[model samples]
Target chain A: MLRYLVPLIVFLGVAGFLLKGLELNPREVPSPFIDKPAPSFSLPKLHEPEAQFASKDMLGQVWLLNVWASWCVACRSEHPLLVQLSRANIVPVYGLNYKDEPDDARNWLRELGDAYVSSLIDYEGKVGIDYGVYGVPETFVIDKQGIIRHKVIGPVTPSALDNCVLPLVRKLQQATAQTVVKRTEVEGCV
Target chain B: MRSLTVGIVLLCLLVFVPLAFAKEAEYMVADPEMEKTVNEISAELRCLVCQNQTIADSNAPLAVDLKNQVRDMVESGQSQSDIIDYMVERYGDFVRYRPPMNASTMLLWVGPFLLLLIGVVVLVVNLRKRTAVIKNDEDLSVEENERLQRLLAAESSPQVAKRGNSSSQKAGEEKS
Candidate 1:
């Protein structure tokens, strides 16, 4: 009876775990860059080839670094939302045009309406690789200190933006503002 | 016939010319030792895009880029452990084909062995119970053995066969 019970318990336990695993989405791999410094890169601006943009350039502000390409189908779905967010001016959004032809990317932005403050060209996708971008249209929310606060893989849905991204941005902004106030107070005491 | 030979030569050229020129894109690290290390490390890293394949085996663009990155890091004199640490820092433990034993992955590492142990225990217990049942069946009472021997004798002897049948019937009734 004890032997029978043991096998039955093990079977039920394994079955339960398998059933739970089946419900999980394999694609939703959690990023390890959360709370870590975002990888730095310098590349030419998509519009202005002679001019350059670097991750260091956006060091003092909380921003969104969106990795996108003209060829990505899912990016089209998130384009309008990004455009809306850009209009709202909640946070400055920078773009990394990953492994795309310049003309195609320009045409895509022109037709869809540009939402980025400035889009950088990652012609070889080296910057995208540094950012651990496996899929296109991945977004990283970087805090003012350049730490990656959050990463959203796939298209940024409206709920994801509202519930997670926007709230986090607001919190980081407030934290930065408080830090600024503390610095000024310290200077006054000095 | 001369034209046919020329045509055959042309066909052979068409079939085998590309094969002669088909060189695999070689990603060679300058140092042979470093290249070996890079290969070993890459084989252990899972291709994030192709979940089932290792970075070394996968030809996906991301996998290729990762391999290139590993090669560059190796050439730059970074230790193998450092390179693995950098990858893990960026891509979590899931990026490793062989995940480290930790709280999150403890079950994953131990589950198979635990199941094997359970299987062994259950198998041993089952075998013991079966053997015990067989032993009990074999250890019949002395009276039962005598009765079995009498029934055998009656079957063999013609004179006592009818008497044996009646006596067996009475014995069966008594036993019941």
Candidate 2:
């Protein structure tokens, strides 16, 4: 009986060990923001609540909304990449600090040379949750139609920005051009 | 009346109701090509902060940073394969959820079948040995029967001899 049980234990132990050692299968599912209106958020400015960033504020134009925080180590690692991305003027890059103090975020921005057009202080992270942020440093690519086009979940890299973002900008521009033509056609009909 | 005032407020609330307001717009996907690459890479990349979640799935800040790194790579005109290779080099294969199969992972592919084969062989050997012992018992019936008869004679010797006396007398008549 023990002989049989010994092999069974060995088999299970080995199988368990192998399973633990195996690579995990992680999926890249589409975020809820795709093809939907951006979630509205009213966050006070990092320094001044008088000039806040709201979801409705990004309508009628394209933009890149990045969620970040000083407490997030990856945000710091990706900071240099954001600096590089600022050079690309495809769309304005804005910051939404997820549950961070204004002073720390300001210091981080100051050190990093302020890549965002303006930073919104989401001290409570409620706004970040509404955006379906699983964590910090998520970036959404928004088109002029106020629809979310793509989401990047991690830090920015120079190559990633050029290869993934520029093409989308081009696509959005093409779409905008078609709309301009349709508008002219509608005028002619009138 | 208070009822009238409440009705007005209710009407106003009904007209401009606030339901579950989800801020879905926080995610702005890039162009199709770039978004595809970025999302793909994020799925493969590990979020160091939440070590378990991939950059594609985790809502953690680290996940976002890793995603931005992938985006940066895409924006810099690097190929998907190259970016992944670079990440692997920097962070080791642990960074990728589905790492490329190689010598290091051979046990993962081949271990289960080997274990099953060993288990089946052990079972077959045990069954064969048990059946062989049963067949050997069938060939020893005569010796076992004699031993059982001797044991009974020793226990009831006097009574059994009187019964055998009549048989002996019959044997003498047969001889004459």
- On a 0 to 1 DockQ scale, where is model 1? 0.60
lDDT of 1 by residue, A73-118 (tens): 9999999999999999999999999999999999999999999999
DockQ of 2: 0.02
**lDDT, model 1, position A172:** 75
Look at candidate 1 and tell me the lDDT of residue B157: 82
Best-performing candidate as measured by lDDT: 1
Model 2 docking grade:
incorrect
lDDT of 2 by residue, B134-171 (tens): 98866657876675455545446777686556555554
lDDT of 2 at B36: 84
RMSD of 1: 7.1
Candidate 1 clashing pairs? Answer: none
